[model samples]
Target: MTLPTSTLDLYWLPEAVEFSTAVTALRAAAAKGADGNADAGAAAGTARMLANQRLDFLQTRTLDRAVQGLPDAAWGAELTLAVLGTGTLEHLLPAIRVAGLRRGLRVRCWQAPYGQWRQQILDPAADLHRQRPDVILLAVDPAELLPDLPLSATAEEADTALAARAEEMVGLWRTARERTGAVILQQLMPLAEPPAFGHFERLVPAAPGALAARLDEALVRAAARERVLLLDLGRSLAEIGRRSVGDARLWHHAKQAISPAAAPWYGEQVGRVLASLRGLSRKVLVLDLDNTLWGGVIGDDGLGGIVLGQGSAAGEAFVAFQRHLRQLSRRGVILAVSSKNSPAVAEAVFREHPDMVLTRSDIAAFEANWEDKPAALRRIARDLELGIDSLVFFDDNPVERDLMRRSLPAVAVPEVPDAPELYGQTLADAGYFEPVAFTADDAGRTRQYQANAERRQGQAAATDMDSFLRDLDMVLAVEPVTPVTLARVTQLINKTNQFNLTTRRYTEPEVRDLRDSPDVLTFAARLKDRFGDNGIIAVVIGRRVEDGRTLDLDSWLMSCRVLGRGVEQALLSVVAASAARRGVERLVGHYRPTARNGMVRDFYPGLGFTALPASAEDQGWSLDLRTAVLPQPRHFTLALSV
Candidate 1:
């Protein structure tokens, strides 16, 4: 019942934990915890009721987090939590509704047809387009549900069967993607360690290694193809050592004794990941180099002594950890490093380490020095020039983490482990780092960060700004939304935060819906300087208003990557000319301010829009379409068709 640190609590992650424990408690309360000698008999009768009450409480808490986290403007949004197959859905649906009603979201659970029913819940194929949800949570395992026969198999063998089952699952997901634009995400099989076979295990296996891996591969591959998200509930369970449903003793201790005052440990983790995924943008991963990233301190151990490689246990763990980070970096996570070691030592390890997954060039920023981490983080923020809050900091020392948490609190700090093996799962479990989608720019992040460092160092040595700009040979591709570039455009609208003018987050469904509206216009801007191609980084959303004579800017947001280089003007010009050609009377612009959006408070005024004093709780400003002058840059050119 304690208030969570953030409204973005992950209730879904703990569904398995609470449910398993509730079942155990129901039996226990029914047997011993009830009435006298005759009362003891009565106690057995009340046990199930008591357990159900506990189950109801846990479910209520889950709903509370979701309801509390729903953004005010998103109230009345038709939210649907779809439990694809049977298991926890029966219990979860009721709790989700209670939570949804409290939050003002019109939420409903779509129960899929049982054997006798004629698909009472509309087929995803039929209802997806019309029954759009702000977010979709799928509890069923497609890989398990796909036509397969492995009832007699052990967990490991079943996992093999599941992997073999992936091709079909992938196809079905693709079909689902074609049908609906709603965000699709699958929950990990719950942790029921030393899991026994029955209803749940009969459908799927419990071997964490083979089964989980195959399922993960299947889910991640499907997510990549269908734009679905894979949230790791299994990893969350393992983190707390709640290995299996039989770990009732551990669950009881966790719930009653160990950390009674803390937020439900399970729910908190779930909520954190969910909130982050809901509002993901520019997934820049800034790693720490030293005892944190590797095993031993780089400065003390020396480059050769630093723990990494396949030889030693610690070295192997570090190597494995580095590989994982590199994988994330490759998946469009911008990689950077902050360390208190000498740059020479850091570079030597990056370049010379045989087992190293990342090199000196992979990092966006290599801030190594005597300066405290917050200061280094500031430099990394300035070098990348992104809001520090967007950066995810990983450090071995709790002191450094506390520094950032206390000083610049917005940055996400996943709890760090002393040992190396735990590093892989802890990082994976921290949802702050999860990316919903990847673009070409994401894949090239390491190289871009390396390029950024070189560019900045080059700029520092240059005599003047104009000389630097001219020497960079930056290429800008200002173009209208195309079929190929549509995904990145939607990603920008959904993710880009710091430089976003209005901070209006959009779902892919809404972005697709824009296609049918004649009044709405959206554009994706691609930038490639002498540094590197920054993929698609800017999105501008506006509508033709005033009887189709004027274009009014509804949302104009850009990733921090392309901010400093005067791309905004090119973006505005793109919109301006499109409006000019459309025979619109004028182009109107607006700027509304939020705490994080203050960086662009003067954005509209800078673009020649008059700032009106007309302010509401969510402030508003406007510029007349007629009075604004369209500024075109000789350096930037546009290629687009309205």
Candidate 2:
């Protein structure tokens, strides 16, 4: 029997080509390929463009088939997500799934009973509690949030009502956290169009617009909690424009708060939040120099000849792009240069050019040699101690961009618009570097890596390993898991690939559960040296097993920056002592091999553990406390806490 064709087969089409002749040919091919046998790239490109043009084009059947066709492993990570909203959100699911697929996430979405916001959260036995999600998105509409407010209400009444509603909202978030331990993504109330008071809306403090602003402020304060993230749907709506984003007729007929036209925009914002949670956020922005940073080639144009700064229109555009890059640098995104120009020539532009906003100091690494860009990018990744996948490369040359995309599929190589003026907005729209939480560590990460390089250079110059270790003046501070360090600990567990024994990943709630459990001991290791502080370099999670006689190491990982600085030994010593204090007679360790963690395959056995044969794929090792002792590092001044 011939089965009906599915739209899922068209999801892999290539984007539109520029040539009119090519477009005509592709359009003909697309028509002929409608039977699911067309060129996969062309079909995918057609489907994506159509989906963008009209969200209704993304059929539920297509999404279901696309999801089911994905291999179990294609769901790189599972994110159990629950959505609670005042209006119908069933129409938004397909868009959300499309966004999730783009980010390599499998989003299992659960929708709350319609308009049951308060009951679903307040009732302990609600289905939301039974299905513990990793993330909860609260999408209550503005009208529902301020249901008691009247247009003619007095200022005092409005103020009181807003305060009470804000309190209730925050309390619900706290209650949800206390019950389910899921991270909350709260959507700020959307701004209403055509203000109730017309031109006098700002004059009336009790007006709907004024009230919405007050509620937004309150939500911002509530979002300071570690597990809470604010999704700026109001801002997204404003950017997407109200004329197309909100449909009054749809709301009146179907209670759909957002128009189908705006579902894709909403889904992108939600997907970014999910990506940040899974640590898929891009860390580095590798930029090309010629025509990318300035109006012309640095090698040929010289420092004084390049079109940069404020005089010409083209020059101002480049400056605007540079200003944007500088803003990104301030917010913890590492920037680097990868160009095929002479190192001296490129250095002169950054060092001497008055129009340059990004100096040499702003870049984490600069590679301006005459080598293949793919090789240069790999070198930059190695020097920065980051995964190639964590990079986003931008080059003005199509050849260079295509080479990067083909050679390194993992790195995001965004197409640069022909005009330099569009560079800033193009990069902003890409949303490759979205962050979940901007910690002090993030702000100082580039400086930290630079300091690490200095430390490495010092280590190489030392006469002996012992001399190098002593010169580092390293200090290892070990502390039991606490609320203050819990976030970083969870981040390390998810992101640290190399030097990770067992390579286990955990969510924030799981980390908290382990920290609070009596049978488990978790500790975070912070290291400092003559150069600077490497915050939370290592973490050890152990569980008391065999009736408390054994301490089984569930996870042990260290930052690559402190790999050879004796921090690992210091961390293990503290763990062993803590176990001994708890009356543990033996220490058990396991190593799970992965493509990235082969460096740590022999980590347990090298630490004086005997191999224990097990049927499981993970290799097991054990150390008898009676016969084993913790090896103290001679260089580190250690402080241990139980």
Residue-by-residue lDDT tens digits, candidate 2, 61-112: 3543434333333345668888987657767666666666555566788888
What TM value does model 2 have? 0.35
Candidate 2 clash figure, as a count: 5
| RMSD after CA superposition, every candidate | 26.1, 29.4
Q: After superposition, which runs of candidate 2 have C-alpha atoms over 4 Å from their true positions?
A: 1-240, 445-642
Question: Which lDDT tens digits does candidate 1 get at residues 178-212?
Answer: 55555666666653222111112223342233355
lDDT of each: 0.58, 0.73
Quality of model 1 by C-alpha lDDT: 0.58
